[model samples]
Target: MANRHGPCMEKKCSWCCDPVKVPANFSDEKIPLDKEGKRIWRDREEIVVPESQMETVRLKTFDCDLLDTQTGKCSDYENRPEICRNTSCVDEKSTKSVDEQHRETLEEELIPLKGKK
Candidate 1:
């Protein structure tokens, strides 16, 4: 992965022009979730993660496993869309800080919103 793009990383993030992480898969798309505050890029045909990449996406939970070991591009680039082709990490906040950052993402979280569980 490091050799494919000769280190596909810089000192800044492609999006928001913020100094970000290693900068992998910065091309990921922005998907909107119907459940409110959740989303992911998907093909115009199937509005969901493909079965073949289900585990891969699930394992990435918060985009941890999306990092490519070769070109640093997403392992699923060929199957990705324009949105996924433009995603980037934040510069100063953890990806998990949806509240503090108030940013949107394609990922979802399980929480007791109304204390039902």
Candidate 2:
């Protein structure tokens, strides 16, 4: 890929690249962390959801193999899978955890697009 230059790339955001879905009860501290304190999700660890069968919602997750941990970017973006291409980095879900100031900035950036068909 010749650097598509999407917003995500410009900001170097890679939050969704590593999708970990633990049970709601699982504590954040329990997640393994790297030396830099970044969460290191277990490879294909099966979590048990409450009030459901043991394997009701088993999420087999691990960081993408192509991700460049140092740069927080995909090494092979041009060859990224369909699922990656379909994800939206600008969605509410993606920004919910961002700090208020950044969120406000994002909202301001989007103001012009509001009410557009």
Candidate 3:
């Protein structure tokens, strides 16, 4: 996962810790459930990538246990996983504002709608 977008330099950034897409074989039981016992992943299906090896799509995400919601920082920054060390929020999408992101998403959705007869 070469981050051509560069390293994550934003202060108080918890985007990486928010939701991680796991393998398709990952157990649903491991996913955290809300108080209503509903699956916690609100939008896991938004992004699905094809895994040729497994011949399936990987499209599930969950909050990392190490994330401190109040502070939006990792509990153990020094001992974070290698994946974390390699992650950065300098990408185009991560740099956009919430409203910009929403607009982009709506525009993306409308593309298919416009294509439809």
Which prediction has the highest lDDT against the true structure? Answer: 3
TM-score to native of every candidate shown: 0.20, 0.41, 0.40
lDDT of 1 by residue, 1-117 (tens): 221211123421122211112222333343323235444333222122324444333211133233354544454444543444344433244545433332332233322112211
Tens digit per residue, CA lDDT, model 3, 1-117 = 333443332334455556555554667675655457665444444344423323334444556666677877777666656566655534455767644543443243111112211
Which clashing pairs does model 2 show?
none
Model 2, runs deviating above 4 Å: 1-6, 19-42, 46-60, 92-117
**How many clashing residue pairs are found in candidate 3?**
0
Clashing pairs in 3: none
Give the candidate order by descending lDDT. 3, 2, 1
lDDT of 1 at 105: 26
Which structure is stronger by TM-score: 1 or 2? 2
Best by TM-score: 2
lDDT of 2 by residue, 2-116 (tens): 3232345546655556443333345656654545766645444433232333334433345555678787787776666555665553445553543543444334321111222
